[model samples]
Target chain A: MNESLFPAPAVALAQADVPVWEAVRFTAEGLVPAIAQQHDTGEVLMMAWMTRETLAETLTTGQACYWSRSRGKPWRKGETSGQRQRVLDVRLDCDGDTLLLLVDQDGAACHTGRRTCFYRAADASGTLATLTEPLVDPEVLYGPGGGHP
Target chain B: MNESLFPAPAVALAQADVPVWEAVRFTAEGLVPAIAQQHDTGEVLMMAWMTRETLAETLTTGQACYWSRSRGKPWRKGETSGQRQRVLDVRLDCDGDTLLLLVDQDGAACHTGRRTCFYRAADASGTLATLTEPLVDPEVLYGPGGGHP
Candidate 1:
C-alpha cells in the first residue's frame, strides 16, 4: 500500500445505489473496454468493446454481449459458435471506463479455440514465445473461412 | 476444455522468434490494448492504450509507457505520481491485438488512489457496489488539481 504523506481524505466513493448501467462512464463513442475472465481459474480470456445497450442486455440475458467495433453491431458471445459466456459477475473500474466480467465459459473463450487469448509471452531476449496451444481447432470452431484474422 | 467434435488442425500458429513489437497487430490507429497486472497477486491493475513507440520504449526502458488518448501524448507510468510500474513480464494475446504486462506496481494504479482501477462490483440486484478503497489519497498522489475526472 502506498500510504499518503499528506493523508488527505479518500475521493473514490461507491455508487452502490445507482443502476449498474448508469454507473458506467462510456467513451464519447459510447463504448467501454470489457475484459472477460474465466470464473474459477481467474484466467483472462478475451477483451471486447461494449455499448450501453449490450451491457444492459448482458445483465438481463445473464450472458456476455459486446459491441463489435469492426462489425459495427451488437455481438452476443457464442451466437456464431457454441462458446457462450455465462456471466458470473460484472465489475466497473473506479474511473468507470473499463469493465471486468467473470464468466463460466461454455467453450474456449478465444475464437482461436484456445482457453485464453493471451498465449504469447516475451522472453528476456525480447523474442515472442507461444506459451499455450489451442485446445481446439479454429476451423472446427468457426468452420472454413470463418477464422479470425 | 471444449474439445472440437471435428478435431480439425489448429490455425493459430506461433509467431515466435520475431521481435516483440513486430508480432503485435496494432489497430488501424496504430494502437493496442495494454493490460497491466500485479505480478505476484495476478490482480489486473489497469488497462491502457499503447503505441508502437511506447511498447518499444517499455521493452527497452523496463518501464510501462502508454499513449494517453485524452492527453494526446506519451504517458510514462508514475511520471507525475511516482507510482511507476516495474514491468516483470510481457505477454501478447493470440490475435496480437492485446498485450498483458506483469508488473510490480509502486503505488495506487487508479488515479482515484485505489490499488486497482476495478473497484465496483455489480450485485445480483443490478446495483453497483464499491469493492476496494483507496490505498492513498489522490491529492498526495497527484497534488491538488491533479485529481482525475
Candidate 2:
C-alpha cells in the first residue's frame, strides 16, 4: 500500500521470518554488524552489533533492538536513555546479507545523547566537523533523568 | 581533539584509513545500508546506500554521499534537491563492514522535504505514529522545487 517508497507493484506485506542462525552469519566477534537508518528520510543513524535473540526480539517487538558487545547482552534501544526506536519496516539487501531497517526512533539514537552515534564527520580534505550538538545531555539521558545530572 | 563518548580517550578521535575496493563489503547483495539523522535537532532523517567508490568519494569530498542502486550510480546527498549534506565524520564498526556517517545537512534531509527521513514514532501499545509533516514537498525536493504539480 505504501507505493511511494516500496519497489512498486505493491506486493502484499510478507510475514516471513528470518531465521536466527542464518542472521548471525556475519560475525565480527560474537556479534554481527547492524546498521540503523531513519525509515523515511533514509539517513543512517549508527552501526551496532546484534545477537540471534536480540534480532528475533527486534523483529517480533518491532522496536529497534540490538546486542551490546560491551555489555555482552541484548540491548533494547532506549532501555537506559528512554530514547526508543520502533521498527517501521525491515528490508534485506539484494544479497540478503546486510539488513535495512525502517525505524521510528523515539528520541536520540546515540547513547551519548546525540540524535545519532555518528557525531563526527571526517571530510575528504581531512576536515572533521561535528555536525549536531548533543540532543540530550549524556549524564542525564543515561541517568534517571531526574537527579542524576 | 574531540572527547570520546566512550571511556577510551583519544582512541575515538584516532583516524583509520580504508581502501576503496575493500571499503564497502555489503551483505548478500551489493546494497549497504546507511543511516541519516537531523544535523541540528539531532533527529534521525533517513538511511540509504553506498558502494566502494561512493564511500571513497564521500570520504574525499566531505559531502554526505551514497551509491543509489536504483539510480544505478553514486547519489550525492542534496546534489539534486539542494539538500546537500556535509560530512562531519564517518565511522566503521569493528567488523570493517558497515558505515556510519555524521553529516551537516542543508535543508530537509528527506526527499519528502522533511527535516529527517524518520517522522514516525511507535505508541506505547506498539502502534506507529507519524509525528511530523513533510518539510518540503517530495515533488519539489525530488524533481524541482516547483516542478511537480
Strongest candidate by TM-score? 1
Question: What tens-digit string does per-residue lDDT give for candidate 1 at A1-149?
Answer: 32211121244255576877778889789999898876655567888889988998888888999998878898889887788899877878876788988788887878778887877777655788676777888788889876452
- The digit string of per-residue lDDT tens for model 2 on B1-149 reads 43222212333444436332454457665666565544434444556777666777877777877877656777877777888887655654333445565567887776556665544332223233344566667787666453111
Taking the candidates in order, what DockQ does each have? 0.38, 0.08
CA displacement after TM-score superposition, residue A119 of candidate 1 (Å): 1.1
Best by DockQ: 1
TM-score of chain B taken alone, every candidate: 0.86, 0.75
Q: In angstroms, how far off is A95's CA in candidate 1? A: 2.3
The parts of candidate 2 lying over 4 Å away from their true place are A1-149, B1-24, B144-149
What DockQ number belongs to candidate 2? 0.08
Chain A TM-score of candidate 2 vs. true chain A: 0.78
Q: Any runs in candidate 1 off by more than 4 Å, and if so which?
A: A1-18, A124-126, A147-149, B1-18, B124-126, B147-149
- Candidate 1 C-alpha lDDT tens digits along B57-120: 8888889999998888889999999999987777888768899887889979889998888777
